[model samples]
Target: MKEVIATHSLDEVGKHPDFGSAQATLRWMLIYMVEETAGHVGDLDTRREVLDSEKG
Candidate 1:
């Protein structure tokens, strides 16, 4: 999916529906995914550190 997105042209992006264009939709989705994933990772890391500290 990433490779397919990288190769998509401006014209192809413009053809996307539901968000004015494919690029706009793709850009927002990527931003949202990254932020959400980062938050989850941070939360998991914090929990792991706390658990390890308690065990030590």
Candidate 2:
């Protein structure tokens, strides 16, 4: 999924000399994690709403 692609991109970037800095890697990893979590949360919320409506 998108996570796999993002993980691969992070791995690739971390290996490159230009983005090899520890700070940069950490920053990007944090941002990526946040974005991924947000997407998951949104999906979970949508499912929860659907389930709630069905239960009503």
Candidate 3:
């Protein structure tokens, strides 16, 4: 993925039919990837807190 991104401009557009009909540029994809990763991390952290509290 990094290599592909490196070869293209940030303005380069592509389709993500699996996600939706709307097309997104490389910049948008990168931003979405970061946001999704952060959201998942937050979810895991919340789950960890719940489990730790239950252990008490």
Candidate 4:
């Protein structure tokens, strides 16, 4: 991801045919990736907390 970012401009646009012809810039893609990853991490942390409490 870092390499791709370094090679392309942030304003570079790409087609997301799999997503019904949607288009997004490199900046938007990066922001989406970060947000999605953070959400997943938060979900995992919550699950862990629940399991740990049950164990105690």
Candidate 5:
């Protein structure tokens, strides 16, 4: 299900729907990409913080 959603989202990201202005389409794509990247960055920050806090 996750893969299916990702695939469908990528397909839409490429098309740039006709109803929206070019800048609006680009903005939407940029927001999605930033959000996806932020999720990964948050995960990495969490792991690093945990490692630093551990008594090793």
Candidate 6:
């Protein structure tokens, strides 16, 4: 992926039919993924706290 990105330009991002403009679209996709992962992590932490409290 790094090599591919190195060879590709930001301008070439959304040129293909399925995905759209690469630069803008990929940026949003990455942001979404990060947010989603954070949410999952928060949920996991909450669950851990609850379980720990139950052990007290």
Which is the better candidate, 1 or 4, if ranked by lDDT? 4
Report how far off residue 29 is in candidate 5 (Å).
0.7
How accurate locally, in lDDT, is each candidate? 0.67, 0.67, 0.86, 0.86, 0.64, 0.66
Model 4 alpha-carbon drift over 4 Å, by segment: 16-20, 54-56
Model 2 misplaced stretches (Cα beyond 4 Å): 1-24, 54-56
What's the C-alpha lDDT at position 53 in model 4?
73
The sequence of per-residue lDDT tens digits that candidate 4 reaches over residues 1-56 is 77999999999987665786666899999999999999999888889889887431
Cα TM-score per model: 0.58, 0.52, 0.76, 0.78, 0.49, 0.57
1-56 per-residue lDDT for model 6 (tens digits): 56655676634444567765455655565567789999999888889889887532
Model 1 over residues 1-56: C-alpha lDDT tens digits? 77856877433433445656335455666667889999999888889889887531
lDDT of 4: 0.86
lDDT of 2 at 28: 81
Give the per-residue lDDT of model 3 (tens digit) for 1-56: 98989899998888775867677899998999999999999888889889887422
Q: Candidate 6's error at 11, in angstroms?
A: 7.3
Question: Model 6, residue 31: displacement in angstroms?
Answer: 0.2
The true-versus-predicted C-alpha distance at residue 14 of model 1, in Å, is 10
Could you tell me which residue pairs clash in candidate 2? none
Clashes per candidate (backbone, < 3 Å): 0, 0, 0, 0, 0, 5
Off by over 4 Å in 1: 7-24, 54-56
Q: Please, what are the lDDT tens digits per residue for candidate 2 over residues 1-56? A: 56755566453434556665645454486688899999999888889889887531
TM-score of 3: 0.76
Global CA lDDT computed for model 5: 0.64
Estimate the overall C-alpha local distance difference test score of candidate 6: 0.66
lDDT at position 47, candidate 2: 93
